[model samples]
Target chain A: MASFLEFRQVTVAFGDYVAVEGVSLALAPGAFVSLVGPTGCGKSTLLNVAAGLLAPSRGEVLLEGRPLKGLNPVAGYLFQQDAILPWKTALDNVALPLVFRGVPWGEARERARVWLEKVGLGRFLRHYPHQLSGGMRKRVGLAQVLIAGPKLLLMDEPFSALDIQTRQLMENELLRLWQEDRKTVLFVTHDLEEAIALSDRVVVMSAGPRSRPIGDFPIPLPRPRDVAEIRLTPEFLRLHREIWELLRGEVLRAHAGA
Target chain B: MRGLRVRLWQAGLLLGFLLLWEWASRTGRIDPFFFSLPSAIAQRVWRWFATGEVYPHLYITTVEMLLAFALGTLLGVVFGLWLALAPAVAAVLDPYVKALNAIPRVVLAPIFTLWFGLGVLSKVALGVTLVFFVAFFNTYQGVKEVSPLVLQNARLLGAKPSHLLRHVYLPAAASWIFSSLRTSIGFAVIGAVVGEYLGSAAGLGYLIAQAEGVFDTTGVFAGMVVLMAFVLALDALVGTVERRLLVWRSKEREGGSA
Candidate 1:
């Protein structure tokens, strides 16, 4: 079977400083993979390479078995920071991708309205990014990405800024959304619990200045798991301990270097 | 009702100031020759309106200001975005832009009047000079300061270069440009008025210059008052447009950006 996405021996460097080195990763069709790493582990750099925002110093990133050049058009990216246009209302922000593609304003707006409703922001369509809570802004960001219906989704520490409850709610919402269409998602996070809760496969990365995958664990948890409830299960606890053992060394190394 | 109360308070404050000024002038406590009584200035303004003498000059001044503002802002945004995006151009032009900005722009009024021959064109040319740098620098910063994450996200959502400009760059730059609006528009009015003062036969500035020549302090004061009101109205207009365009700025409830 053909892989949906592949990063072949990728390395990213800025001048003499290497951020990531000799890292390779691949995703199967409709797979959800979480990349777990310590602080400054260059997870974002890897994601950028996949998104085609940054070019690899070595090797190549392939999307759907083709060499991806410039930006990968088959994907949507959700950033850790609020990336919604502050000057545009929630509806307009969600409608932006379609508008950029030369869709008529009225039709795009209608579609954006529907997406906002799906994200539970229908009542606040006219509100700006500033007027929304952090959680609300995250919902807008989610709707903005999903509105385009991309083949792949790249999320970099997307829920790290949220409180635990909001984070779990967003994670559950994400899982529900993912289950419906099954788009390939590559999620980056420092949270082991989040990784275990949300992903089919959790790939553990070592700390920088030469970050690489140290372990890849396929989750055996049943389908449609609630992000909050799954944490209490013995199976989830066992997996957490196994992953944390590998991750703890890297986290300590990152802290000592910092 | 709250808005109305605020307006009423503002009106009362203005009336009180006028009354105090009138009293001081009538009692010969202050020299009315230079300061000019508020009543006299008001009477002069009222007479000009009643006799329909202010219309032609107001029309000419408005035309010059509007033309200069539109032309300067358009060129400013285009060139600013270009320079910011193309690093080579920016590197080459950095010192030159600084040098031009350093030159006291008011001195250019006589030169513009000389080149464009003391007409509306000359006034507009002078106005453009004052407005261009302000709009340019703000727009440059606006485009330069766009979050890398936002740009990457926009690209991953399938934005072309042109699409990026329309959807990402322009909207990002717009808030900065709008912030510069009141200042740049003030410069436009100043340019028109100054150009008229230096050489033109018409406009509010010309009226003040003519009054100063004949030693009619009331006419000069009336012209100044009119100019003040004119700018206030224009600034308010810009505020209205900004509110309409920047609707997304109002919703920042909390800091949860995912």
Candidate 2:
């Protein structure tokens, strides 16, 4: 199978501090991949590099064999903080990508309404970011990216701030979106269960200043998986243990660095 | 019922103040020559309006105020957006803008009359000067305070620089701009009145100056009442526009409360 996205020996730096060093990874088309690591392990930095928000100080990022130069609109990003604009209604926020692309206001809003409905926000289309609960805001944020119809999605800990129940519900909603759209997704999170529950493959990273992937574990669990049922599986437990073991030392080292 | 109660309370307060003023003037506790009774002022205002003496002055002041307000606000928003987005430009112009803002703008009325003549132009110039800084500073602060995370999300969504400005920066700064507009209304009125006071043959300010020269306290009070009414009307119009544009915002608040 051909690689859809490639990060070849990518190194990202801010002045003297290198966030990611000599890191290499490739993702298949329409694949669900998760990067699991301790906080500050540069998972977000790697994602940023992929999204072309940060310039790689070394090596190259290729999208479908073409060198990525600037921001690629084909890649949609969902931030950890929801980042829905406080001034915009849920529908308007969802339609923002279309607006940026110069779609007419009436049509863009109509399309935005469609996406809001998809994310179960049909009733709250006129609601602002501040008006929505945390879970609903996250859903709105997801709808924002999804409405753009990007071939690749980059999510940075998109559900980290939500409560456990809401997180699970959001995870289910995300999985449903992913299943329906079949877009390639690169999700970054520290939750082992979440990584195991959602991804086709989990890339585990060591701590930063020079963070790189230390393990790549394939999740063999069948698709259309329920969060509760998946957690009950021995395979899920085994993968969780493997990832936890790989991440344990890195987490400790990150704490020590802090 | 709640809205009605609030309205009743406001009306009662206004009536009580009017009664007190009327009592003070009728009882000779306050000099009617210097401080005309509210009833006398009202009578004078009615006669002024009935004879169409108030219309020309009202028209003159309103035109000057609206023109100055539009010109000042447009320039302020443009310059403020420019300064906030460009660090080098902001650094270079920061001191000059601050110095201009800090100076007493009312002192410029005479200079404006000298430069633009004793016609409407001078009043407009004065009003523009008064209104500009309030809008400029507020818009500058607003654009500068746009959340970094939101900007990142926009970039990730493939928003071009212009798109970012239109969808993110402008909307982010809108509430701030509206807030400044409310303040700028008073400044705009001050600018026009000050210019007229310095040199003009028409406008409510000119009427007041004439009344003061003749010791016609009723006429002076009537002019002030006219000015106050005009300002309040303009403020109400601005408020209406704000409510329309911010419909999405209030809906969000309602959703949150529910």
Candidate 3:
């Protein structure tokens, strides 16, 4: 398949601190990719570059065949934090991008209601962010991003803030959304299991200040795989162990540097 | 029911203070000339209302307040957004703006009257000056405080600079704007009244000045009471608008719970 998104020899820096360097990757359309590493391994920074939030200092990011000059409105991003507007009702929060795009209030609200219902938050449409539980808030955040109907979705440790049970549920919810939308996804996380569970390909990065991808592994898992089933699969365990083995030394190196 | 209880307690305290004042004045323990009995003030108020003379003065003050408030808030929001979004401009003007705000606004009444004349314009100018700083600082802080994470997420979602301003910056500043509005109410009233006091042929402040000159303590107290009632009503109106606009605020959840 032709690459839909390409990062060509991308490097990112903040003043003197180089976050990512000499990182190159290409994602096919409708592909699900995850970047896994210890904290500060520049996984999120790489995602930022791909999303065009940060310009690569020494390389170019291309969406399709064109250079990505700035942020791509055709893309959606879910942060580690829910980032829901605390003053907006769940329905309004979900409808925000539409509203900004000049959809009238009545129509935007109706569309928002449909998406909120999809996330099972229809009854709590009028509830504020603080009123919802952590899981519910994350779902609302998901709905907000998905309502934009972007071609590519970028998530940075989106489930890390939730408890184990909630994280599992959210992971399943995300997988369902991915299946339904068939959008290209670039998810950044530290959890090896999560990376294996959700991604078609997992990219592991070395520790910063000039971190680059050290390994990339493709998971050959069947669709609609359950968490429990995936855990028991020898293939899943083998991929998990391999990724962990690559990450462990880098993690130790990061600690030593710190 | 809880709201009712709170109002009942407020009323009770007001009545107790009135009774104490009435007893003190009637028993010759305090001078009624300076601190008029509540009953006498109420009678004066009733006379003014029955005669329909209070409305014109009330109307004058209200118009001045509303005009000043609208103008001040508009300027504050615009300038605040400019200062926050433009770092170089903020850096160049910050100290001067702080010094201007620190000067007591009441001291500007004479200067405003001299510049704008003895008409409603002077009062509006004075009121605007008083209301402007409160709103400006709050809005500045609000815009400045927008989460870096939210901005990053929005940018990744392909939000243009204008989109970031409209969706992210403005909403983040709204809560601050609304909060500053509560204080701006008092400033609006003060501005109008002080302007009238300095030089005006009309408004509640003029009535109070006239009453004071004539030694009509009851009339003076009645004028003050009118001003107080008007302020409270205006504040309630602002509160109502805030509640409607910020319906998604967590405080609204408390309202629903109640």
Candidate 4:
């Protein structure tokens, strides 16, 4: 069977700067993958390609055997930033995707309320984005992306700014939610530990000017993994060490380049 | 308690200033002919109000102000969004917009009188010109400056063009557009009155012009006072609307960033 999404020989350039080069990757339906790389190593550019936010300067992005165009209809994106509209209350922000999808306002709001409750933001219905804490806003962002039920999820370091405790809690929440139906996810982050803890496979990329995947490691961890508990295991540590070895060199190169 | 204290201070300051002015004019510290005694001005204003002579002029000026405000704001938002969304079109129009903005729109009062005649049409036309650019620039900036990340997330979540405009563009621009509306209220009123002052059959501007021609210092002062009152009332109206519409932002200011 065809992989649900494919990035074939994708290269992205902005004027004189080449962000990503000759990158080919595939994701099976329901797979969870994390792309780990150094800062400015084209992780976000790659993610944007998947989201169809930026067309690759070279190569094609295919979704379910179709060449994707404009915005990818099958995917939802969670930005590194909260991305929740500050002008909207938590409930309204979560309901925004549904409203865009032509759902009736009443039903969209009802579903958004349920989703917000699921994300543990039941009491923050009327609270604006600014009123909520960062974690609360992130939860709102999660509810916003998930409420629309896109088949593929693209998250760009969605929790990199959170305190560790909040990060772990949100990671576990994401896992629990994703487990209800194993949705395909493409998560990008610089943190190797985070990559290994949350994803079924971790792909490491070299530093830019022409960043491309250096290694792909399929995680052998068991299902129903607790992100916090799984970290204490030797297997997680070994995988972390191995991925860090591959990633640290690229990070150093990026730092030198900067 | 704090708000009341501030209001008390404001009232005291206003009363003190008025008393000082009244005392100075009455005691011949300043020439009453040019400065105009505050008491006489007050009496003149009262007479206009009591005798209902101000109504027709007020009505004409207000209609011109409202029409200018409504038309300018609508055109500004629509055109601003269009230009922001279509960069190519914006590029073409960029020079023209800037050139129009650079010219003092107040100077167009005379030209508007020639184009639209010595009626409310001329006044409205002048007011529209004054109000448009401020609103347009603000709306353009508001739309242009929407967080690209937020926009990307919206698109990935399946927001279509129409949905993007309603949910993202308008809400992002809401505060800016409203700010422009508030600022342009003063300009609109100025435009109408200035146009009328230049040449007109009826309006507060005409009344002021009539007073100025006869060197009736009290009438001029009263007209000035009436114009001030009109502007304050309109500003208050806008302030009320802003408070209601931007309730979400108010919550943001009160809440600390989480």
TM-score top scorer: 4
Please estimate how well model 1 matches the true structure, expressed as its whole-model Cα lDDT.
0.89
lDDT of 1 by residue, A130-161 (tens): 77899999999999999988889999999889
Error of 2 at A111 (Å): 4.1
If both were scored by TM-score, which would come out higher, candidate 1 or candidate 3? 1
Worst 10 residues of 4 chain A by lDDT: A79-88
Error of 4 at B178 (Å): 1.5
RMSD in order of candidates = 3.0, 3.0, 3.3, 2.5
User: What local distance difference test score does each model get?
Assistant: 0.89, 0.88, 0.87, 0.89
On residues A181-202, what C-alpha lDDT tens digit does candidate 2 reach at each position?
A: 6899999999888988999999
Task: Report the interface RMSD that candidate 1 achieves against the true structure, in angstroms.
Answer: 3.3
Tell me the tens digit of each residue's lDDT in model 4 across A1-258: 689999999999999899999999999999999999989889999888998889999999999989989888878888888887777889888888888878988999999999999999998899987778889999999999888888999999999889999999999999999999899999998888889989999999999989999999999999898999999999999998888888889889999999
Over B185-256, each residue of candidate 3 has an lDDT whose tens digit, in order, gives: 888999998889878999999998888899989988898898888889988998999878776657534322
Pairs that collide, model 3: none
Cα-lDDT of candidate 4: 0.89
- Candidates in order, TM-scores: namely 0.91, 0.91, 0.90, 0.94
Summing lDDT over every window of 10 consecutive residues in candidate 4 chain B, give the lowest-scoring window.
Answer: B249-258
Q: Can you give the lDDT of residue A64 in candidate 3?
A: 90
Q: lDDT of model 1 at residue B170? A: 83
